[model samples]
Target: MSSEAEGRFHIVDVSSLTSVHRRMPRRVTLRTDDGVRIEAVYEPSRASVTDTAVVLAHGFTGSVDRPAVRRAARAFAERGASVVTFSFRGHGGSGGLSTVGDREVLDLSAAVRWARELGHARVATVGFSMGGSVVLRHAALEAGTVDAVAAVSAPARWYYRGTAPMRRLHWVVTRPGGRLVGRYGLRTRIDRRAWDPVPLSPVEAVPLIAPVPLLIVHGDRDAYFPLDHPRSLAAAGGDAAELWLEPGMGHAENAADAELLARLGDWLVGG
Candidate 1:
């Protein structure tokens, strides 16, 4: 793995952009710190109302091309901030298998770097499910690289199998047959090995992200993680972080409605 953390873009004819193409979504490829190829899309803001760019991260089985991910990105763009949506390695057009949220921090970092390289004065990240945990860890690890971070339906701690969805998720990542299902059924490639050193959990990383404007948004009806997960993260974040418990909501990106996404965009740009 190369020590280089900044990403290099590919496939997007990033030459001089005319006003006509400036609003079109441009597809690009990114190389991560550990050297993984990622697929991404860059969408210019509708109104160009904010200098902040929003980097969006998807869920466990989600990708940059997923409807939920695209919806969030479009909504953010409509709010007047450029948006970069990327598929983590192993999902979509990216290369490599998923390490869940551990090594995925590098993935988010790459997207953030790309957003900054595009000349955005500030960058904010909003991630869902597996990606939710990645944003917290990435902000904590990269510190001031990003202006703000928001995580939705993220688990506070690791190895949580309390919920039925989580228990099934464990099966999908750990077992060989489950891995096959993850690959063939869900189009998500699973890494066969478990965490060697067991990276820091989201709650553990929350304190490190203090004063960076962290937001933890979770649903009261999340089937993957209970309210305790967000509560634990909020407690760790203390006053530095804001917690929003969405009533009657479900889980991850699919559950994130336009209203919630618009509210998220408002909070991110405001922060």
Candidate 2:
């Protein structure tokens, strides 16, 4: 990789074969509040952009190394925004089992804190699917945690099996046999435990994220959660939230295109 100065822009050429397609430059282990150690990667922004940072939370069954997550991170970094991506517990190299979205807030909190420690004055949290729900809850639970929040392909409320994909997901998350498949087949370790108090719903958490800029992105063609999901979240988010329903998109981070990701990166830093 080589760095060159061009007026106000700081250009980093990562296209060289020796440095292309490699992992991030900085990698660290963060400990969640519940004592789970998670693996996180930090991609520094271009020299011109050093004050704002974006933390990415992957969806259920996804890791920091997942292609979709990495693509999004690289997109943000390429646009001169520092990006931090981490695996929720039980997903990749992280410790502990996945409680789905229930206990994942701790994971995001740790990542956000790390970004702040890295000298970023403004931080944004962007999440997909289960991670999206987690970001809402985290923002609600930990006030002043982030300057902006973006949730993509997230369910407004939990326990809905309306779509066939959701039905299959229910089977994967609720049944013992399904969990066995998740552990072995999907390589996603789902805890055999249940939500005790059911935690907090994303719609309920939306109002609590007030005074902070919020962007809700979802595909109109998403097979997992339909339009009603983002609609409900926007309704709850009120005037502080902006919602974008894409026409031909599918699901989560995987469905995000280069242009959409660039727009999201701009939104994070108030561009």
Listing every candidate in turn, what is its Cα RMSD in Å to the true structure after a full C-alpha superposition?
A: 3.5, 9.2
Model 2 lDDT vs. the true structure?
0.84
Candidate with maximal TM-score = 1
Writing each residue's lDDT as its tens digit, candidate 2 over 103-137 gives: 88988998888787766778999999999999999
RMSD of 1: 3.5
In terms of lDDT, the best-performing candidate is 1
Cα distance off (Å), candidate 2, residue 197: 1.2
The runs of at least 3 residues in candidate 2 whose Cα sits more than 4 Å from the true structure, single-residue gaps closed, are: 1-24
The TM-score, computed over Cα atoms with residue i paired to residue i, of candidate 2 is 0.90
The TM-score values for the models, in the order shown, are: 0.92, 0.90
> How would you encode candidate 1's per-residue C-alpha lDDT over 1-271 as one tens digit per residue?
2221222456442233343543567788877767788888889888675678899999999998888888998888888778999988778778888888888988888888777767678899998989989999998888899999999999999999998889999999999999999999999887887888899899999999989898999999999999999999999998899999999999999999999999998888778
After the best TM-score superposition of candidate 2, give how far the Cα of residue 96 lies from its true spot, in angstroms.
Answer: 0.3
